[model samples]
Target: MNIVKSVLRATATTATALALLAGPCALPATAQTPARPAALAAAQQAKRPNVIVILVDDMGFSDIGPYGSEIPTPNLDALAANGLRFTQFYNSARCSPSRASLLTGLYPHEAGMGGLDSIVRPGLGGFQGRLADRAVTIAEVLKPAGYFTGMAGKWHVGAQHGTPPKAVGFDRSMFQKGGTYFPDQPGKGRTFVTIDGRQARLDSPEVGKGEWYASDMLVDWTVRFVDEAKVAGKPFFLYLPFTAVHFPVMAPADEIAKFKGKYMAGWDQLRRDRFERQKKTGLIAADATLPDVLPEAYDWDKLPAADKERFDTIMAVYAAAISRMDKAIGTLVADLKARGEFDNTLILFMSDNGGNAESGPDGRTGAAPWGGKYSNIFVGLNWATLQNTPFRYFKHYAEEGGIATPLIASWPAGIDAKVRGTMVREPGHLVDVMPTLAELAGAKYPARFDGHDIRPMSGRSFAGAFDGKPLTRSVPIFWEHEGNKAVRDGKWKLVAQFGAPWQLYDMSTDRTETRDLAAAHPDIAARMTQQWNDWAAKSFVDPWPNKVDGGVIKGRLEGGKAPGKGKHGKGKRKRAAQAAAGA
Candidate 1:
């Protein structure tokens, strides 16, 4: 078994490689940032524990109950209340990139996912639609180590060349390329089922053709996969990434009804309520200030009165989808508990990126028919901004709201009860997931995998944090999606919009990123900026856009507002107006 190396021990080797990065700056180690204790109990309890990673798409930082949402996610909350919560966990600000980073213990670009695959161009080293042969996935690594690796849910990593879940590493895989969550609703995506590398039919009644919800089918099949692993007496690594809460937004009518009037108060009140709950739950600092609306964002009351009911319905569908996902999770957990597998399993819950503000192309481009068809309705910017409560901006930007995500790690036999329900504020990224799981499974990441050379992992495990020990990551975390980019070094973060000037923040105090310290602390800004540029070059990050006026969101140089619209005007009325017209 190749034990995962500690961050402290890898520093010297990484320093030489990243000294200049692709340029010259060395990070100083201050008193260790908060760390997790060693999970000695879980490691020693048995040969290898079952590893399950549950990923949700387009979810905001505070959308779940454990993360301070008004949404009643009892199962998710119970897992968190009995496990660990990461206060500063981050995603890649978009879907496929985030998934790439999570699957491979390397930066997204290094894994050939510089941006969404839809727009990928040939010869673009970073935007290649497939996972590079040089990068080995966690499944690929663990499968060789006496493990049955399986995956069920969204597979957005690659399209051709066996890039599907089973092709990469899973032994028994079920997934769709990417699509709406309501399976019964007709949409533009296809669902494929594969077992032991052979195709399985989803059209059969067993898979639920007439009344299938994505979340329900996922957990149901996953339970069966676990049962197979248990019967064989082999440890399993299951990666379940759900398509819940994405868009076109559909859920069971009863579940939707439960939250029908719940959001009548409007986004402003919802943001305030969530912020208050965050403080009460110790998720954020008690004195943490709430953020003002983004320049393009508008007030809920400002929405046309005629459109109020429709918007409310959209939000209801969203909330209901969340609750439904939680219920399915509860069912999956119950199965584990019933089979006597709950105590020794390590389950992780996280989001692919922040909440989406896209109202589609024309605000109502993909409206869902009341008769149960696949819908592509964008929730628009108002409620999305509210979902990111206390943080500014939404998905597709490098701001805290776009990247921050709720991460819950639960393992009764692995994590110490004393540290359960506790918060770890150390900065971590999705790249850390692969290494962490490999460490727990005692699986070695090889230099060469599957007839090709493998890339070295750019992540460090936080297993020690489970024991309540202070930890320091070997390298700072970096992010880039579209044109939004950020580099977090210790307490300072340098963030930039596509084709915009870089803005610096002292995250130790202003995690909301309300203040720009670039001018005040030019020295820190320069050093971090150099590091960002170097990383961009090394990670295949695209060059800055030519001509400053081409970038999105102007006037951000001084303050955050878009143009004439005040921070709280809601958003450009064109989309909402179109949505109202049912265009």
Candidate 2:
């Protein structure tokens, strides 16, 4: 019996050794098999966490409640309460460039959206056209890894007839052509869109009604996509870029009614209140200062009564629109929880640019005139000031008010609750999302995909932050659009407006950029400036000439009126009549 038992024990030992040799584990005899590295083990167990990126259009750094605004964004506050909030998150100061950087994991110029253009036109030197066929998006990299991808929002990277989301690797897409909320405009050629491709249109009058806010529509489509993806048993990535709180200041009447008198205290007091709240919430430093009063053109107290009312109403509408957006976000969160996907999903919420202050001195909102060049319902400048609360400059500039944003990321299954409620001061940008998602999903970024030789990713992954580890970025981040440029290497950032001298700041101590350290740190500033110049020479493309000149008027309007419009006098009208007669 002892001999038989010995034979059985020997057989069992042999079987165990062989199994270990063939499987992930190795036999004890096989030269001490090493344990898997922590990073590799974490990547293997990533489970392709469902990715939902929610982008709010034209929202300011302090727009949300948790970010120290008077706005009642309970849903967004709830998101921050349950997730990680980033105080130093950033994006480009404008729309198209930010989207371009976010998707391609490269600087805006590297992705071919060097500057804003409604359409690529001739004579634009350096305008590389839309997102070049060479850039590889996150969708393209993740699709082959058995993940479904969909985008339902603003896709402003390209505007040519054939350059919709599908052409850029999105499996299912529903997006608008331009950046406005004009669904009633002619569908095929007149700008406003409700289509999947270039041809499809929403025939239902329900959606065509003027009351249908763009944010609500976007959220509806997003929720439906989530449901459909779950039914198909496929993990999905949904990019919902809602065009809310942008110009035109339109919202459902009911939502607008809630905030009718909310801003009657005027921007001066409101800015102070918001700034104090931000300090109390620990969102900003105690030493931070309120921006100096705006230039004479923006003196709120000097405006006429009618103008004040007009601006007030416009802001009221804007606030209502964002509140509705918050409600929609709440519904989406509830839906995800209902489906049992909330715990495992990685949901990220951010704005595509800082609050916009593009309204000209004449109070024209956005790029288009109200009633569009054809109507009288123009949005005024009051709302623009309110949009960029507690900040100096607005969209199109490189100031903190224009570029800073709030980022909230929630993942119950992966992020610890204690760490979730904490605010992270590590600086991160929109360009980092693609690589981070790729690393978290264990997906490879191929050298070539779909007939394009992709450029190597310029962004480093922040996935280490999920496990509460310090994130270290090695490369210097750069930005350029229409000649506005910036470079950040650690705490030092160098910036320059178009046609202006470069300025430097130590972001660690002066995030609001009150002090320019250009003279103090001349060597560091010069080195960083040279670095940006080198990057620009490589990635630079000239702005689209025709569209560029059409959008922004170079200098401020004189005499408080647009060019070609005569002064408010009969002599000006007579000169206009003479010119018409000559024509």
Candidate 3:
């Protein structure tokens, strides 16, 4: 393991040589990345790549330029242009579970995070509200194999279960349960983060007063960690999970200005535009059909002019949030290049889940300078339906719209040139990240860690996909959250909404799941349902309505406020929502 760092540091001389070969202005002016010199590329590739896994919150499949969005994500677009874009990547349908899966290379149930971390059902083993002790994180696997592990941003997996990031494996970390974009925003409680194991204000003097943005803060810490890794002379494994494009959504005014009034065309047209773009960019199958706008989505044409204006402004904020994150990414990429680590860094960008429509179909947007819980804007079903273009349902469902996520990987020295700027049609899940990093970093997935028998990884390494090979997954992918269950077995997908019977789709032909084949092919549906049930039972998944706390726990879809709540109860629900959003 120690020898790996030595080889990497020695290989740095080759990167330096290449830099000297180029003039003072080393970076290209255009969007196209320059070709790497053969010798230098070989030298860097021989050593371990600096691994970065970037997860964004509540973003949809087509929310970025590389995917299908009109919103400018120049940095992300550049990465996709220079590397690989995956068309069929999927995430667990919610936040905490997805993070658990991404870190541990296991299904959410196996990682002990089947529900939101805020929902703690004591004695109900699978829904423990945190990561399982037996699961090992990518950081844990990589650190012992000569990597400096660091993390910045939301760490929603409960600290009570498997401890926080620093204790798990990260050498340095700064994280909170949820997002509080502006620390100084009045009436909104500040989110104190655990930094290097110490609790501190998220907005320190280093971040200038009244200038604390969560995305920038995350990137600043990432850059600092990278510099620290350089001093330690080790390859770095940095996890940056940004809390952007999520509820309580906010962005800089100037950024919001850039897209104000731009969404007047509304969800209907924007979704169609994105769908067309997806087909044109080869991010979706050319013959693929777009599913109709969700039934819950508002009719843009029916909305009053004032409502249209309000909707446009809020969507602008959503766009601003994404574009701002993109700008921060550009900064990170530039810093990597300045250190001559850009080519050797394997950067992976993905979303935790699909678009959120938590506040309801109509959505809600509060007054300026959002301070309290539920006080910020939610794009709601209308805009969220657009965000997950050509798909059905929003977040919290076991549908393509909820689970689908765009995954982009960039490694100038590692990815094959033949696949650059091309879309990969192979289906992948968040679980694959750990194994991929383990393979690229030459790290071993241990059988035992900290005297506990570790859970075997459910994911296989998709590193071959980087070289333009197929991601030949042997087993089917499964999902279950709040009673929404699904199984993706090759071309067939069996999905069921909470309290609903299974609906099957042929993913090879109808990736958007517009057509239900279950009635026509009942045999396939029954077989897959059996497979899912068998897997779920063995994987610690409690059946819906299972006993918990000595009572029958009825299913509460979306985990929102109870029904029949009047105005006062509505206020309480909002407060609860605020707490949950931050939690």
Highest lDDT scorer: 3
Error of 3 at 29 (Å): 42
Candidate 2's TM-score: 0.82
lDDT of 2 by residue, 396-416 (tens): 666676678889998888776
lDDT of 1 by residue, 218-328 (tens): 898788889889887778889998878776566777787887767778778889999999999888888888987754555666555545565676778788889999999
Q: How close is candidate 3 to the true structure, as a TM-score?
A: 0.85
The per-prediction CA RMSD against the true structure, in angstroms, equals 8.6, 11.8, 9.0
Estimate every model's Cα lDDT from 0 to 1: 0.72, 0.65, 0.76
Candidate 1 residues lying further than 4 Å off, grouped into runs, are: 1-45, 191-202, 360-371, 544-583
Candidate 2 wrong stretches, greater than 4 Å: 1-40, 117-126, 159-161, 178-198, 205-211, 365-383, 541-583
lDDT of 3 at 14: 36
Superposed by TM-score, candidate 1 places the C-alpha of residue 66 at a distance from the truth, in angstroms, of 0.9
lDDT winner, 1 or 2: 1
Residue 482, candidate 2: alpha-carbon lDDT: 51
TM-scores for the candidates: 0.86, 0.82, 0.85
